[model samples]
Target: MLFPLFFMLMFPVECLTDLIEPITGGVCGIMTPEQYSEDLYMEDEILSSVSLSIKESGLNDVSIAPGYGRLLTMLATVSKAGSILEIGALGGYSGVCLARGMKEGGRLISLELKEDNAALARRNLELAGFGRGTEYMVGPALDSLKQLESRGERFDFFLIDADKENYPVYLEYAIRLAKPGAIIAGDNTLLRGRTLNPDKNGPSVLAMRKFNDMIATDERLISTMLPAYDGLALAVVK
Candidate 1:
């Protein structure tokens, strides 16, 4: 009985870390594994039930955790954002969050690479009643962003949460697309705790470090990194 209870107690912790590991690399300095798991589960439940048909598409796991979702909503509302851009549309979970906080007559353009993922995202958004407000572009983000730039499209808020290696390149494009005073946020900047140690030396970790250093030194934007959900970097375009 004692052994069984002990196993039960430890199981959730392992599960939570496993869930977050893909994004955070199991590095959460501010929150305990149990706390993170509990919080993430609650968040997942809320988003999962939002009438999004794609809710059952296994894309919810690709969405931002609850804490980051809330933050995105708040920021969109606070900025009175009418135009938004997202580099990644993984399952449309974050798209729903951003759309919910959008001002009246707001529009969001989300880019995704995989056709199946785009379709799933569309389904999710439609289910959430956010489909009308979002445009799902199925292709590489770089190509899509270039098209937007060519069309002279600009956004009030931008969120970057796509490929790890493309962060800096995304930053450049985001900077070009943003209006002055617009907020640009990048997810997973911490790369788990590997960034702090510096010795682990994975490609993602190295990319994050380079991006962090670049952001810190950049004069065009005011930037800060938050330790929320594997780490988020927030920058306000000047």
Candidate 2:
């Protein structure tokens, strides 16, 4: 009886997509509470294994973390990014998400300094059926990015998640290699929410604050920082 009632309620399931505006109140926010709850209903076993691997490797604390993974995927999908560049590929968790969102024939190039982490990321990408769409380059992001530039590679989307102190330099490189209308996203801009306090003296926090200030005043791009995991700064090149 309950199943019949539920089926009747959802008989016109196609209508839900059209109702998104009313359901979400036309606000540009992350997944709603309902959506989040629904996400918890479906679990990807490979993703679970990837998370466990990061934890077992003792790098969970310093890695991209969980919620940010979903955010990256959303960005790639919304932007319809066909060529993506990720400055950091900690354990491949985020890479999996980003790769999954790539348009058909799209590709993602991820940079990582640690061989072990890169290997793990490669495995994770393969597990997610994104092995062909994703490439892991082992080296400092700055060096790798320079090589990409030298090769005349331009990306439709850029994700910066490398060493915080080098964000300004990374931002410059990202801008240079990004095509007009490309989207650039930076992770950890909030530095654990310390960006608002101004009392933190750590180099990462300070660098993030300075980078934020620099981009905020730049005329070439329109940017905004979203209070997501840690924080995410997104800019669209004009």
Candidate 3:
């Protein structure tokens, strides 16, 4: 049932290819990303408020796009994830999205590097009604991942959107801590399309390419990369 629902929700994304098939003068389909967000992607107004606050606070606008937020919610919901681990928490925008998909009593643990960022995330999550079931661990995410590993904590779903260079490590930790059949998702896997450039050999690009390869060839999981919105990599633990 969940798979069916997931596919139904993905119909729009699937049709996207054909939508721009007749690429007249290289223009994308009839809708821009903003238009798609406004028309097709349903976002919570609290998210709007969060975005505004982030801008007001002069914080880096690193939050996921609205359509991507909707994607996170749908993935979490369809996976029936009881426990979620988010590797990055930017003002709790993604946290709220994941929390909205949780079954009653589902737990969400977020690992953020900066104390200020985590603090803002906590406050925003509280405002979004997810404070009770969400946990925030500030400092390096790799350290937190190690701690979670030591504690033998397992998650039903994991979302990685942190530093690009550590993506492989994060993916490994996520797999190790994942429950069987757990879903592992990575945002920005395309690394702003640097992974596709033959000339760009930055550390981030190399790491992202390796991460994508692992997701594609790893025998322990079945995965696919959605080549939109900075690229979202999704895999299921075998």
Candidate 4:
């Protein structure tokens, strides 16, 4: 859980801290994580501005951190995605990142639980000049995901940042809705190191662990986990 703004940044499978105060961790060649964030994390006035809005609006401050945001953008761009699906839209911080990577006519569909949060994210995305290409489906995320599945809609990229408890379910749906060569990325999968804690057998932790396990073991996808802020799991759907 961490931020360019971290909760439900894909849909985190829980409150994976997208908007928590930036912490210094992770390792680079020479610079410290704090130094890397201060120096390497690209600066985007729009994202910075949106982050401020979410913080002031009393919304979940656990927005995805700028580091993860940049990574999402790069991944989306590298994948040359035409359609991106985001499981959770919190303040549109990650949405903007994902959309920035889309090919010229790419589309982005975001699922959010609360009306207010969705409204806010919609507004922010519009502000980011993604109005025409962005769509929002509000209500329980599972319901919207099911609707998408029923409609036979598929995506080139999938971001799972919602409820940790439902992450496995979400991953199943993602696999079901994915196109060949699609990319599936998840956040807070490390559950702030809880997954590695043998002492923590809590339900959410267990679920997150399962999420990681599925990604790691599923033969349909090739995946890896990055031990940075919280943790990041990235997979390529085969």
Best by lDDT: 3
Relative to the unseen true structure, what is the Cα RMSD of model 1?
6.7
Going through the candidates in order, what is the number of backbone clashes in each?
Answer: 0, 0, 0, 28
How displaced is residue 188 in candidate 1, in Å? 0.8
> Which candidate, 2 or 4, would have the higher TM-score against the true structure?
4
Q: What TM-score, over all chains together, does every model reach?
A: 0.79, 0.79, 0.85, 0.85
Give the total clashing residue pairs for model 3: 0
Give the local distance difference test score of model 2.
0.82
What's the CA error at residue 81 for candidate 3, in Å?
Answer: 1.1
How far in Å is the alpha carbon of 230 misplaced in model 2?
A: 1.1
Evaluated at residue 35, the lDDT of candidate 4 is 56
Across residues 1-35, which tens digit of lDDT does each residue of candidate 1 receive?
69966765765564756644675434334566646
Q: Find the number of clashing residue pairs for candidate 4.
A: 28
Cα misplacement distance, residue 30 of candidate 4 (Å): 10
Please write out the lDDT profile of model 4 over residues 107-211, one tens digit for every residue.
999999888888888899999999789999998889998899899999999989987899999998999999999999898888777889999999899999889
- Score each candidate by Cα lDDT: 0.81, 0.82, 0.86, 0.86
